[model samples]
Target: MLSTNPFALSDTRAPLYFSDKVALVTGGASGIGMATAELLAREGARVVIADRCRDDGEELAARLRHEYGQALFVETDVGCASSVQALVGRTLLEYGRIDCAINNAGLSETPVDLIDASGEQWERLMAVNLRGVWLSMQHQIRAMLDAGRGAIVNVSSRTGLVGKPRLAIYTASKHGVLGLTRSAAIDYAPHGIRINAVCPGLIHTPFVEQKFGDGLPELARTMNPLGRIGRPEEVAECIAWLCSDAASFVVGVSLPVDGGAVA
Candidate 1:
């Protein structure tokens, strides 16, 4: 097993579990993606931050470089096959192989009942949230298959497990992610690839701010058993562990990083 000491990562000498590993995180410009990228880089992974947010992506890559880690920023539209292909190509051109990948590029739509939701809304969300993951894994898995080892973490949502009013399209997209994760996990596990999904609840992110804003306080209190929204880093921690040797035995689990909401 590719193991590292289980000490808290804050310790400077904590074994660099991901040292020399090449990690690619899509949607890495902000939110959970950003947190995961930062954690992976801090732990000694050469990271590629792929996102449409060019400024944030560039700035983050620069910061990691300054911290003495190798990082690259690629502006990508995950929904585009050509774009995602170019992303993997660029990563391989620079680093030679892909050791880990997190398909986190997703967007949410304003709440709308399924009946009232327009086809345009559904297509747009599915493009990024579902097809994007599918496109990414097709390429990522091929790279890992050649390398003989890899890990993939797909970000879903609590709604993927259950249902919520006025968010049917988003729910479908997330649920699709879990389906992709599990089936691929089963297919590739014997090939030395571990695939899993993280279903996060209401998290405190820029997306959340845009979605809930001033009502966040009230929203947090009623949303989950923990009575508070989750931090992006909390989900990032779960993702990192899943990507590590610590979780070598884990596969195809749609772990709820939510505050016991699905319970």
Candidate 2:
């Protein structure tokens, strides 16, 4: 059986590679985004948690500040361009520059056959899953361009690589994210900025718990070779690595953190 406490903070004592750097995480109120924010802050990055869940976001930020040294929460709707723009603006105003970013905000679709998929569902998924990444990248790239260097990690999913029976809209949105990551990486590589993606399998996040409930663990066991669901911190580690100088040579790669599920 896989370790039960996969989210344990044992690894938080790693070297402070992110000292003096500033990092931003969208959808950071909970789950993989929250894990990433905490990990980055632990590694010495001034973190900004941006999400629409005001209560949760603010609470997470406060906890981060109490544990780490610096953290801020900005209420944001990644689906709205203005909200995203303001998020970036506020981060810049406070930190002066964005050294790293994890565009983790996204929405998933309820299982429904493509034939029965509503246009509204498609639009909603695209707005947050695809367009949010695009919008976040636009402002993030501009900031990196000004600073002359940066790193970005867009959180895609294993679904982005393979299609599910009733998840066409989600699959499409995630695929779009990979396209955006690759295209943006190429465009910004020469300018000293790197972009990449992480395709997580079934992670045990609050979102996953809400969507799948008690069935999630059994489903996870059958889906991945490791025979268990992944933890948010597991994926968060990948995001932090991609954002660090250690991954300076890594760019435009869609890393699968799926416990051999994609293998």
lDDT of each: 0.93, 0.92
lDDT tens digits, residue span 9-63, model 2 = 4553443578879999999999999999998888778999999999999999999
lDDT of 1 by residue, 1-263 (tens): 33254425653375377889999999999999999999899888999999999999999999999984699999999999999999999999999999999999999879987889998998999999999999999999999999999999999999889988898999999999999999999999999999999999988998889877899999899988899999998998899899998899999999999899899
Best candidate according to lDDT: 1
State which candidate has the highest TM-score.
Answer: 1
Q: Give me the overall lDDT of model 1.
A: 0.93
Please, what is the TM-score per model?
A: 0.96, 0.94
Model 2 CA deviation exceeding 4 Å by range = 1-15
Off by over 4 Å in 1: 1-7, 10-15
> Clashing residue pairs, candidate 1?
none
